[model samples]
Target: MSARLEAINITCRDHAASGARWAEILGLEPEGDITSANDFITYRIPGTEVYFAFQPPDNGEVGDTFVPRIHLDAVASGNTREQELENLLTRGMKLVVDARTADGAGWFTVEDVDGTQICVGRSDEERAAAKAAREGSS
Candidate 1:
């Protein structure tokens, strides 16, 4: 049997805030009503079947040392990678990693308001070119 991934569930202290942050970051809107603070909120990334759902933590206690096991990686669309990084920073996301190659193909990791790490990079073509250069050098 094969398992098909459909949605990603995120637990946060404030589901509404987290959902809003994700929506703004992805340029998506919440799927349903987000008025209720106790209710979970979901957002579907454009051009993707996957959904991201945010809910309050079950334990009701915010863990100061909790680190997410998985981080999300995204490719910049409709803008240059530098612009995308600037946009994210302007939105109060903390820059964790900033790396670039000679060809200017690189990625940056930013921590969102909810402390979720998201890595944004250039498009596929730039990635392919960087990979080819690396392989050729090797």
Candidate 2:
């Protein structure tokens, strides 16, 4: 059996606010309540079958707490190279890693309001070339 990605759980200092930010970024409407005994809220990216959930930080002082590292990577559609970067920036994303090169290659790594790192990339020509190569091999 193979493992599949279904949901990602993120611990945020402010779970509700983090949920709202992720909902806006993913063009989704969040559901659930952090105060409803569950202490978490979820945002689902429809048609993609993926869910992002925001939960309260671990119970303890920072020095005694364990925070898990969480990062996600995604591919953007339409345009090439910097279009996803522009869209993310317009939506108030903070740039973390400037992976773009002078030769017009590479991708980007950005952070959300809750400091969740997400790497996004778009390259039509490169993808097409790779697809063609794969098809040729097939």
Candidate 3:
């Protein structure tokens, strides 16, 4: 057997709001709650089978309270690098890091509804190349 990155799950305070943000940023659509308990939600990548799941914060802390931390790195589509970061900022996302260099690096760190950290950043060329590959495959 082999282990693989199936999905990245984070805990959120508001399911609907977080899900909506993810949908807009990642250009994804949610089908339904990931589980019957209605605590987890999934957003599917357009041209891939991978998924990102957001759940509720963990309870039953015995000692130090754990702050939820997770991130879903999605391809930036049809948007400038700065535009992507700014869009999320307008939607209540706080910046963690910002850089636009020729080397195609840097990332923005933002917290979810539950204070969990997520880094969103990638170059336009990278995204466009991925889009082209996806289009070619499809």
Candidate 4:
């Protein structure tokens, strides 16, 4: 049997703050009480079965050596890529990398408040459609 993806658990020094920041950035409402330090806060990406959960460190401390290697890739929704990038910046994400293709499709890598790198971009289909629309309008 094939295993299905469930949830991505993130260890945070301050789960509440990280949860709040992520909720605002993703335009998602948190599922659990962010104020409760004993429980994890979860955000389910819209139109998907996947979930992102933020929880405090198990040892009650996030050491200086702790560095996250995994980065999340998210598609832009409900807004243009530029608008989404602007929103991310306004919500306190630091810009890391911004790249684009000749067709005007692009992606941005931003570091969240908790220092997790998240790449936000458009899909190949979306890029093709956008390019077609632009050509038609010209």
The parts of candidate 2 lying over 4 Å away from their true place are 1-66, 129-138
What is the C-alpha lDDT profile of model 1 across 23-106, one tens digit per residue? Answer: 898886577777775757878877886678787766666788543333566776666677777888888999988876767777
TM-score, candidate number 2: 0.44
Report lDDT (Cα) of residue 63, candidate 3: 42
Q: What is candidate 2's CA lDDT for residue 26?
A: 78
Per-candidate local distance difference test = 0.72, 0.67, 0.62, 0.70
lDDT-sorted candidate list, best first:
1, 4, 2, 3
Top TM-score hit: 4
Highest-lDDT candidate: 1
**Which candidate model has the greater TM-score, 2 or 3?**
2
Question: Which 10 successive residues of model 2 have the least lDDT summed?
Answer: 1-10
lDDT of 3 by residue, 1-138 (tens): 111233577666655567778879989867665345366788876777667787766663324565555765543445655666777677787776555456565655666566655555555576566578779999
TM-score of each: 0.44, 0.44, 0.41, 0.45
How many clashes in each structure?
0, 0, 0, 0
lDDT over C-alpha atoms for residue 64 of model 2: 44
Q: Which residue ranges in model 3 land beyond 4 Å of their true spot? A: 1-68, 99-102, 127-138
Off by over 4 Å in 1: 63-138
Model 4, 73-130: lDDT tens digits are 6666656566677887888999999886776777778888877877777744566788
Judge candidate 3 against the unseen true structure and give its global Cα lDDT, from 0 to 1.
Answer: 0.62
